[model samples]
Target: MISQSLTLTWRSLVPLKNSPGQLLAMLIQPVFMIVIFVYLFGGAAGGDRAEAVQYMLPGVLVQVALMATIGTGMNLATDIGNGVFDRFRTMPIARMAPLAGRILADLCTMTVTLAMAVLVGYLVGFRVTTSPLEALAGLGLVLLFTMALSWASAWIGVIAKSVTAMQGISTAVLLPLTFGSSAFIPATDLPGWLTAWMSVNPVSHLAAALRGFTVGGLDAADVWITLGWTAALLAVFVPLALRAYNRRVR
Candidate 1:
């Protein structure tokens, strides 16, 4: 199973080789967006450039993490549409091989996005005040959350009618969850109703947890909340995605 999954992972990565433009864009987009947020709107958002980058970087990372998964469903849908799964079924690979491989491949891309975001954040005056270990833990939290959500995305990919439809549906769900969270602004700054919702938002907790890691000491409550959210996403989505994969293959 592991070898088969690895092989499929390599196969999944081949697209990156073929489409250099997409890979270049993937590396560039986060840097551009973070710079705009920090340099252009920094004063308006957080009163000063450095302060705004500090306040906004975590939220931006959370948003990027979520956005990174948006393409997972679309790619999975494309593979299914292209009859790739049919070919896979003929091989003696584990049932989950293709799905797991695709998820792992996406992780590679997410790693680049996260690393580049941090580098760019530093260039624009974002600093991590917490210990190095805590900063690492914060990045782990982002990866965990993204991996969990990507399973849900894989499920959507298998179930959606088309690749375009998959992208549309995933974007519709992610955009609101990201923008509505405490990522960009303080929850207190939002309206009461939205604030209440943001308090429960997984993105909000994840952002807060990350902010604590990068700009302040740990927040035990936020860490636990983010873990709970990650667990919930994985528990609910993993089985659903596997089931969807099974159905699609059949």
Candidate 2:
């Protein structure tokens, strides 16, 4: 199953090779976002663009990671719509192979986006105070968190009627979760009610943890919270996604 899934993961990435422009477009959004945020709103947030970059880079990465998971569902819906999944069913591969493959392939794409985000951030004065290894671990954490979220997306994609529907559903959920949390701004600045909600927001923990790793102070509490969320998401969504995949393929 592992080998089959790995092969299918490679197969899933073939589209990017054929349409390199798509990859470029995906990488461009982070650059634009970092520039706009740092130059326009940075002064208000952290007193200057450089300071803002230091504080905002982690949050920006959290937003980007969450946004990227939407593509997992959209891509799966497209494959199903095009009958590619139906063709896979005729093969003798393990039932989990296709679903696992899609998630793994999405992880690779997530890494690219994360790297681009960091590069753009650096250009805008985002510096990592932690060691390179620690920063890499932070990146791994983001990927793991994203992978857990993508399972839920995959389940939605498997059952969604169309790619548009998948995207719509994922966006509706993600927008609230990503933006409502402490991703772009300090939760303390929010209203009492919003602050209450943000306190428990999983994305907030993820963002805080990332910031801790990048800025030289590891928040052990936030790290534990984020890991708990990741485990919980995978625990709930992985089985559901596998079931959805089987039902859809059958």
Candidate 3:
């Protein structure tokens, strides 16, 4: 199963070789977000551009990681819609290989996205005040959260009736999660009701945990909360995704 998944992972990535534009777009996305959010909204939100870079970059990393999962769903939906899974059905490969392959391929792209975000943040004056190990841990945490979310996205892709449906569903769900949380502004800046919601928002915890990891102040509570959320997401979505994959393929 592992070998089959790895082969399919390469198969999934092969398209990027023929179409470098897709990979370029993925890498450029985080750079654009960093520039727009940190530079444009920094003064208004964080008192200055540098401060904004410090505060927003971690949040942006969480946001970008979350947003990247949408592609997983879309790709899965597209494959199903285009009958790629049907081709897989006849092969002797493990049933889970296709789904696992898609996810592994997504992890590769998301790692690059995270790296690009950090590079852009560095250029914009965001520094990791912690040790190199902590900075790496920060990236690892975000990637872990992203992997959990991808399972949910994969379920959506498997169950969605069409690629357009998958896209719509993903955007509808993700937009609120990204914009409603502390991804752009502090929770204190929001109204009472919104701030209340932000308190429970998984993204808020993720942002806080990432800030702790990359910046000077590391919060143990935030890290625990983020891990809890990751576990919850994986518990709910992993089974759903696998079941949905089986149903879709069968």
Clashes of each: 0, 0, 0
Cα lDDT of model 3 overall? 0.90
**Candidate with better lDDT, 2 vs 3:** 3
User: Which run of 10 residues does model 2 get worst, by summed lDDT?
Assistant: 40-49
Give the per-residue lDDT digits (tens) of candidate 2, residues 115-145.
Answer: 9999988877889998998898888888989
Ranking by lDDT: 3, 1, 2
> For model 1, what is the error of residue 197's alpha carbon versus the real structure, in angstroms, after optimal superposition?
0.8
- Overall lDDT per candidate, in order of appearance: 0.89, 0.88, 0.90
The digit string of per-residue lDDT tens for model 1 on 1-250 reads 9998899888999879889899998889789889776777677557677789999998888888899897889889999999999999998889988998999899889989999999989888889998999899999989998998999999999999999999999999998899888888888776899999998888988999999998995678998988888888889998999998898889
Worst 10 residues of 1 by lDDT: 38-47
Q: Where does candidate 2 stray beyond 4 Å?
A: none
Cα misplacement distance, residue 223 of candidate 3 (Å): 1.0
Model 3 stretches with alpha carbons more than 4 Å out: none
The pairs that clash in candidate 2 are none
Compared with the true structure, what per-residue lDDT tens digits does model 3 show for residues 1-250? 9999999999998899888889899989998888888887887557777788888899899999999999999999999989999999999998889998999999998999989888888887899999999989888998999999999999999999988999899999998888888877999987999999989988888888888888868888888988998999999998899999998889
How many residue-pair clashes does candidate 1 contain?
0
